[model samples]
Target: MSASVRAVIFDVGETLLDDSTFWGSWADWLGVPRHTLAVLVGVVTTQGRDNAEALRLIKPGFDLVAERAARERAGHGESITDADLYPDARPTLGALRDAGFWVGIAGNQTERAGLLLRALELPVDAIATSDEWNVAKPDSRFFERLCTWSGHRADQIVYVGDHRDNDIIAAHSAGLHTAHIRRGPWGYQNADDPKLRATATWRINELTELPALLISSDTG
Candidate 1:
């Protein structure tokens, strides 16, 4: 870890947010069993395909945007609730801010998700989404926007997330430090891959470990 790091940005889904309800809600909308959708999500993940592919597998040529709109009209829209957060999420983020790090949340989530997160009033300096910025992760432009929003240079920021490709690899490639949190599906799966493990500056088991990692890195 670099002493130059001054900010910590987190991914939303599966990092701070549990996301089980997110998927289950989709299953309910599609009239499929939650377990069936869950299994399909796992299959897509193992294949390194987009998780949205699971929805497409259920209904070919699925227009995600249209479907989301239709769901809203039908009063079955995506929702975010307090229970969707990992228990450690708020405390860790608050701890980091208390320790004097500029903290933010940015992820490949929709504008609605962004608004919902802001509504929760998370102790963050900023909260942004791909939909809000019109760019998504693994896209260099997205990281550029993150750096800009963070008010710090890329190298001076440490991004934390669960995905190897979208979070660690992509953030590292953008010249930012990365912490891989091993909690969610992608987290558990990537933790087993030695090469992917090597890509992150640090690996942690939970969000609570982050403040200590940053503090020790500063002191060490």
Candidate 2:
């Protein structure tokens, strides 16, 4: 698998940064109650896979997250910017680039993820925003677009992200290898499910672990 891979893609939000404190603060400032907020966390961390149908059960929280995003923007006059990525992420990306992996973003996200990437100040192949695609991960077209843009076959690339269903599922459907970043509540929500793990060709925590994970199947 390592020999075949030429590139790697990443999901930006919770997979990369500790976004809970920021999002939680936003929720409280926007007046969402704690219980409703917990359900909203479920929808977002799980990524509203059921979406409109999930709305039937979580309508209030869904609307609440949306409303909070709106309120935070109004109250602060802008969304979050320059979020701190976990430690060693910058060096890890540099190492992957050094190893000739065409690194990039492959999942859905917020405006802040861009700023985080910019802060890294390294060259990556591209950042495919699922927000722009208007279709999040687990959708084949999203992965297809990534493969097309990177000019590689599905098997030639790897999709790394936080969500089991969206990023890994979409990458698998596209025939790419998957790297599941098992961290925080996000990974916890889906880790116990075997079907989710099946999509990930690799699973990891620290970004610094990625280069070796991508390049060294020789580990014994």
1-220, model 1: which lDDT tens digit per residue?
3378799999999999998999999999989999999999999999999999999999999999999999999998889988899999999989999999999999999999998999999998999999999999999999999988888999899989999999999998999889999987899998967766777988999899888888778522
Compared with the true structure, all predictions reach lDDT values of 0.91, 0.67
In terms of lDDT, model 2 sits at: 0.67
TM-score of each: 0.96, 0.77
Instruction: List the candidate 2 regions with Cα displacement exceeding 4 Å.
Output: 32-69, 72-83, 110-123, 218-220
Q: Which candidate is the best by lDDT?
A: 1
Residue-level lDDT of model 2, residues 51-151, one tens digit each, is: 33333353444574475467656774223343556665557667888898888765665454455455556557676566666666666888888888788
Evaluated at residue 184, the lDDT of candidate 2 is 61
Question: Which pairs in model 2 have colliding backbones?
Answer: none
Q: Count the backbone clashes (under 3 Å) in each candidate.
A: 0, 0
Q: Deviation in angstroms for 45 in model 1?
A: 0.5
**Lowest-lDDT window of 10 residues in candidate 2?**
51-60
